[model samples]
Target: MSPRFQCKQRGAIGLMAVGVLAVVLAFTLLVVDTGRLYLEKRKLQGVADTAALEAVSRNGTCLAGLSAATYAGQSVARNHFVVGNGNTLVTQCGAVTTAASGQRTFSANPALSSAIQVVASKTVTTSVAGGIWSLFSGNSVSLNTVLTATAVAAKPTPTLAQLSIKSTLASVDTANASLLNGLFSGFLGGNVSLTVAGWNGLLNTNISLLSYLDQLAINLGVSAGNYTQLLSTNVTASQLVQAAITVLTANGATADVLTALGNLKVAAISQAPLTLGKILQLQTGTTAAALNANLQVFQLIQGVVQLSSNQSAASATLPVSVLGLANITTQIKVIEPPQLSAIGDPALAVANPLGPNAIYVRTAQVRTQVTVSLPVLNSLSGLTTAVNNLVGPLTPVLSGLLSLNLVTTINSTLCLLGAGCQQLDLLVLPGNLPLNIVLDAGGASSYVTAYSCPTGSAGTKSVTAHTTTSLASLNVGNITHAFSSTQPMSVAPMPLVDLGIQTCHKILGIGSCDPRVPFGAGGIAIQVQSNIAGSNSIQDLVFSSTTPFATPPNVGLASTYQAAAPATNLVSGLSTALNGVSITAYQPSGGNPLGALAPTVVALLGSVSAIVTPVVDNLLAPLLNPILNNLLNMLGISLANVNVGANLTCGQTGEAYLVI
Candidate 1:
């Protein structure tokens, strides 16, 4: 019983041992082969990633001479991944598009190469498990299998471009300084006093945009390097000024400039909160390095102050005085704030320079209204005498043109008594009359229309911008209501004179005359309305290496609106307006009383135009021309000309990162 049982148990134990050995060998091969494949895959993935990143970082393109494939091959070689030795590396150029939901998609485009894609593959022996299956099934399966790894890399930041708009005012004089002070004071709702030197310092000084933003971020307690948030954040005018002061102080600005800035800061306290994005526009995904451009201190301050003013209820009052006029009040309001500088992707801007998403900048749009109280004719003995001498001879002619019995009736009825006689008096311009002159200046605008960065040299970089100069309109009349920044101002005929009667009462043996009463109901109101057309034009601004981001170049754009042939005869428009004076006759209630006297009134106006034109020209030319020109210059607005500046940096080489 024992011998046969022992023999069977030994055989069974040997069979079990052989089976366990085979299973252990198979499991070991599977583990080793799988681990080797995994390691190879990992290595291949590393090579592909490195190749893609190198291709993009080197600015590789699919265009003719330098190809992304060539760059990727070099990177693969450096990584020790040999090609054609059971290993292959393929590269393709493409662009990365990001959706609004933050989803990224890659599209292969040979024409555009914003990103590079690399595929690395190696042919390796089939897995042990498959080999075993093939052996069991008696089928001839392939020995080698392809293992591929793919990677896509692109520039972390986009191609950045910056444009700056500067004021045409290169230097400041005492007169300009005074005007600037009055303007800024009016905008800030406080007093702003700066000397000519101080203003000139601001105009000449330049501030680094990056440094200013950095300091501003720090002051605002925003996270470092978060320029997008900093730009969109709401900040007070004082904060913006202080940030500029800090940057200027670090750059060692003149004491006068700093002091002036300090004064401006104090004045800016009354201003409302505003975002820097209004004045300085930065497109989405703009890199921090692109903000290294420079900005003029005057332009920056002016833009910020203008933005503040646009949001505030305050209006600027210009300190100007015209001869022969009393209570001269001038008010200026900003209709739209200026976009002083912009940084963005040139590719996006190229589609439409003035589109909502494009990189564009513009000067402030402003409206200036001047109200002048006409001199009291009776009070001014000399002016009254002069006016009487000029218009007294035309009274009989005016009576004939009016077709009224004003002279006869007054001579017969009033002079019949000779005790309390009433006399008809001809007043050219009555007292407490207002003469309003409104000037609306549309600011200039500039935007990047096209740009190119040559593959090889940075010197050949070129950027083009389309600029449109300002268009302005002028109106001379009487406006009853206050000026508005948002709504358009309407002009009504300005009352120039009153043809009326004066009644005298016998008192203490002396003839005393009451205030002059208008004829018919009161008097005839002679009003004049004048309008001047605005001129604007479009031009191209080409920037080259000479106008780099460090130093911007300015170009003056002359308006297409020709001001007479001589160009200096700006008063010719006034003359034209005065030539077309319209005489209006009003009855006691409302309607015009003179039904058929329009043609006669026109003839009368022709006669009176010669005399009134000179007086008006003399009175207004000296007063309005200087004020308008000086105000326009200081406000960065012009009817005849505009100054625009431009700066462009194609893009900087940034770190490459995987996008897909």
Candidate 2:
């Protein structure tokens, strides 16, 4: 009885031991399988990261607008897990986007087109868990675990490194509102009015060049391709205006840009990169930079145009004596025509400069008309009663009023058709009394050249271009004066003023007596002529990019602007036009009684001319020169001294990074 019971107990104990061993073996197999799956997943992640990086490192360009980077990434991921089954991989040239539903999605956005996304998946077949599940459930189960890995990478590029600014000399003068108004009206095809503060706001504002590009890219719905994208996008005038407005507002600018912005139509399309660097005209480098600044060439031009267009015509009243008689008031007016286009191209020279500026400004043509009235009847009225006291009896004499009118005008044009050239003309005319007088001055032609430096340093500065003003021409009535291109301005026989006189003899017992007067000594003439004949030279100014400022108002890259020394001869010529003035009195040959009074008349007229000289030489000439100079300065083609402004630097290599 004991032996049988002992055997049964031993069998039962053995079965329990075998069953526990099987369970331990199964658990070990499951652990090993789970570890293998984890290891493979980690390996896949590494492969995906490496593949994405490799794809981005290669040029992203592909045929048919397809992403070569995508194919490259897929090939790399597949190579890394060639031994795995159910292997799947996908690569795309896009970035991850999140939806409102908390889901992640990849979309083809141009801004993120440079990035590469690589995803890889592999299936791991189960060894023990699959069998156990099948045995228990009596059905085939997929013990195949799927592992996925994803990565994103981008390529490196080059960008702007530093910036310098060229110096500039600018002044504000609203006295010539007519000229401003005309110019503005022509540009906008309508009237505009801007206050001094408004003009200052535009002129004083600065923008970040790099930031501007980024804004433009955003507006155009394109990606900022390390600044290269600027070359591919074309913005219309209105679009450009909007983009500029964005920059100005972003910088908290206070300029009144709405008028110009609203007036701008689709007259032109502006390209980037070259257009941005058009003023500097750098021959080397890709012209693609991420340099940021407060102001740029185009922005400055736009500001100026907007400011001018928003102003009304210029007008003013001045008082002056006429022929040393009664004081009279004179009115002056100046008008400026609007420009059709003022855009620019970086690839063009100063004349062409990639493309023509949006607006082409011309010299303001000034027209002046002067009228003089004399009180001849008042003097005769008192003397009429005293006629009987003289040796001869006189009758009641009739008195007549006399008036004189004179007109003068000046005009000029420069740099037409992107030729970087200039030309000018002037004309003057005296009233229709019995004398003819005329005065004219100005050059026939002028050419300009522009310059730039690679590093934007001082020593690298040079004459980017040069200009040649053709021989100047001067004329006075019948006389013609010519000046060579190399000679200073000079004109001969510049007839200035002329007057006619008459005399009459009284007869006794008659109501009125009249006598004929010869046309000889009774006339007055004044003129100025120049003898100096030599060529003149005028220098144009150019500016360079400037360093950034640390303050709020000037917190941007500035430029160093250097103006060419103005040709002293131009000033000298102006002085010459006013110098060498002379007054002349001619003698009569006929039996005219007025001949006897020529000497006394000459003395009186000489004194009158002397007074007029101060008004013309000191007041008119001085005032006119500054106005013309201002016009030239506003054109940005010439400068009187060196000026510096905020600017941004460019031309440096840059690396890309993973955004996600």
- C-alpha TM-score for every candidate: 0.63, 0.43
lDDT of 2 at 3: 98
Please give me the total number of clashing residue pairs in predicted model 1: 3
**Candidate 2, 1-660: lDDT as tens digits:** 699999999999999999999888878878897778778888888877777776666645322344555655565647666634687767676544446797756554343445677777887776566667677998776667678888776654332222232213232346433343343444444444555444444455556654566677777776554344453444443455567677767666643544433434332222211133222222232322223244543334443343233232333323342112233333222223212111122223354533332112222222222222223211333222321121111001100101112111112222223222222121112232211112221221111234334553443322232322222222222222121223443323322322222232234544332232223323434454442222234443333323233211111234333323443465566566555445555454465332444555455554545544544455335333533354333433232332222122222235545544
User: Quick one: best TM-score, which candidate?
Assistant: 1
Worst 10 residues of 2 by lDDT: 393-402
Q: lDDT for each of the candidates?
A: 0.70, 0.40
How far residue 164's Cα lies from its native spot in candidate 2, in Å, is 6.3
lDDT (tens digit, per residue) of candidate 1 on 109-176: 55446688999999999998878888899988879878999999987654666666666687997767
For candidate 1, the TM-score is: 0.63
User: Which residue runs of candidate 2 sit more than 4 Å off their true CA positions?
Assistant: 1-42, 61-183, 194-236, 245-260, 263-615, 619-622, 625-642, 645-660
Pairs of residues at least 3 apart in sequence or in different chains that clash in candidate 1: 518-522, 518-523, 519-522
